[model samples]
Target: MRRLRMGMIGGGPGSFIGPVHRIAAELDREIELVAGAFSSNAGRSRAAGEQYRIDPSRAYADVAALIAGETARADGVDFVTIVSPNHHHLPAARAALAAGIPVLSDKPATATLAEAQELADVVRGAALPYALTYTYSGYPLVREARARIAAGALGTIRKVVVEYPQGWLAGEASGKQAEWRVDPARAGEGGCIGDIGVHALHLAEFVTGLRVTELLADLAAVVPGRALDDDCTVLLRFENGARGVLLTSQIEIGELNGLRIRAYGDRGGLVWKQEEPNSLTLYDLDGGCSMVRAGTALLGADAAARTRTPGGHPEGYLEAFANLYRDFAALLRGEPAPLLPGIEDGLRGMAFIATAVAASRDRAGWVPLSV
Candidate 1:
């Protein structure tokens, strides 16, 4: 199969997510970065292209020019990856799809709920392959957890608890990352919830294969002078008669990427932690507990397919991110790409953010999800 070419929008110098996207896309040797509008500034974009060794002609001034120039070229990119801020996600993806190129976008879909719905409509109408990078679901162990739950190893899930905490924004805003995240204009209605809470929400739903039917949220701006909520706690009711809790905060001092999930069922319970990505712990009802490590024979077919090394060889964030790219590339090659998060997941995330914000605003008891 031919190596797929990729173009990127955003992720220029000092940008947090752009290099991660580029690195993940290129990890498996299935895709190459052929072009990019790396930044809003034309000079930075060109400089980023030079740093990546891309041809100057392909490095356009902005997203519009990148889409136009690449589309006109015979060797244009096969797909476009949007790593821009949340506000740009909708427009960038729309432009790519309209130009007949597929899109792999960063999470939360759009800056607003209305835009997310419209984007969903456009993608469905276009009938193209559009994927959202819910990076946590790419882990081999996470896949193993999902497979086990689906097989009823954890029978009749009754409770779920997920949390994501970080201290990066605990103090006064000092960096570019903190600046946009705390600003409602760039990050949308949610601050911490939109940034990391969605990841926690998506992980819980992805593993249990259950939909959150309704939720009650208490969101707060913990830090002084912050415009958006830096702390959030949500109570969830699932379609399968399950109850859950979600906690996400950027002001938890000394905590760093502490994302974890636990699901309890009638028969057993399972626990997974993001910082310790290689292991999953399961506890049976009969006082029996076992730790399942990644790359082991216990993993199912989907998990084994995603595993890269033997058990005890640690694989963390970058590898997980790469798995999504690998699956998307396989999909573009017309092969089976099960478990890749697509437009529906993106839409669901946006809905969750919107609903949580509204629920918090009104102090409503439990708001049904309107996705």
Candidate 2:
């Protein structure tokens, strides 16, 4: 199988997510980093591209230049990974798509719902494949959960509770990660809700195949006078009559990306924790409980298929992220993609954030979501 020649738009020196994106894309051995525009500053962009060992000529000063030059190359890249800030996603994606290259963007697709809608529309009309990295959805256990729910193993989906909490922003690491995220101009209409809450919301709906028709939300400033929401909670009404609650926060003391989800149907419930991606807890209505280990003796095909190593060997965040990259590559290859959360998921996530933000402003009142 020929590997996808990949290029990146962000992940310049000292950027956190860019490295994560690189590792994930490389993990499955299906993508080769061919070029990049890594940063806004020309020097930094070239330096970051050099760090990846790409030819300096391919490390252009800006996204448009990268698109122009790369598209002209005989062996151009397969796609561009947009790991820049929320504000950069739209322009970068538009450039790539217009150049006839696919895009795999980091989440919250754009800074605003309107922009997100526009991107979705463009991608839909272009008939090109685009994916937003709701990374947790790429996890094996999460896939198992989806499989079970779809197979009627869960019977009737009833309730979903998902929460993602991290404390790096609790005090003040407010340097790069916290700074760009809280900026309305760069981060978009929603704050913590977009940064993490949307992940929780996506996780729930992805697993249960439920659509949140309406919701009520509470956006709180747990941090001292942060410009954007540092913490939030939302109550959800799924189209299938299931009830759900989501809490995503960056101000939780000592919390570090502790994302968890639980779904209860008429017959049983499935619970998975991000910290331990290799295991899922299953609870029967009759009070019997069991743990489904990723590499254990007992494992479903969906779960087993996603597991790359022996049960004890840990395959985690990087690997889950890699699964998404691999699946997207499969999609581009015209092969069967086990899974890929496309532009539709991106639109719904943006709508969730917008609706939640609106609800939070209206005294934590219920808000009907339209998508």
Cα-based RMSD of the predictions, in order? 0.8, 1.3
Error of 1 at 270 (Å): 0.3
lDDT of 2 at 13: 92
Maximum-lDDT candidate = 1
What does candidate 2's lDDT look like per residue over 60-150, in tens digits?
8999889889989999999999999999998899879988989999998899899998998789777777998999988988998898899
Q: How far is candidate 1 from the true structure (C-alpha RMSD, Å)?
A: 0.8
Off by over 4 Å in 2: none
* TM-score against native, each model: 0.99, 0.97
Give each model's whole-structure lDDT.
Answer: 0.92, 0.88
State the lDDT of candidate 1 residue by residue for 286-361, as single tens digits: 9999999988898889888888899999998889999999999998888888799998898889899999999999
Q: Pick the candidate with the highest TM-score.
A: 1
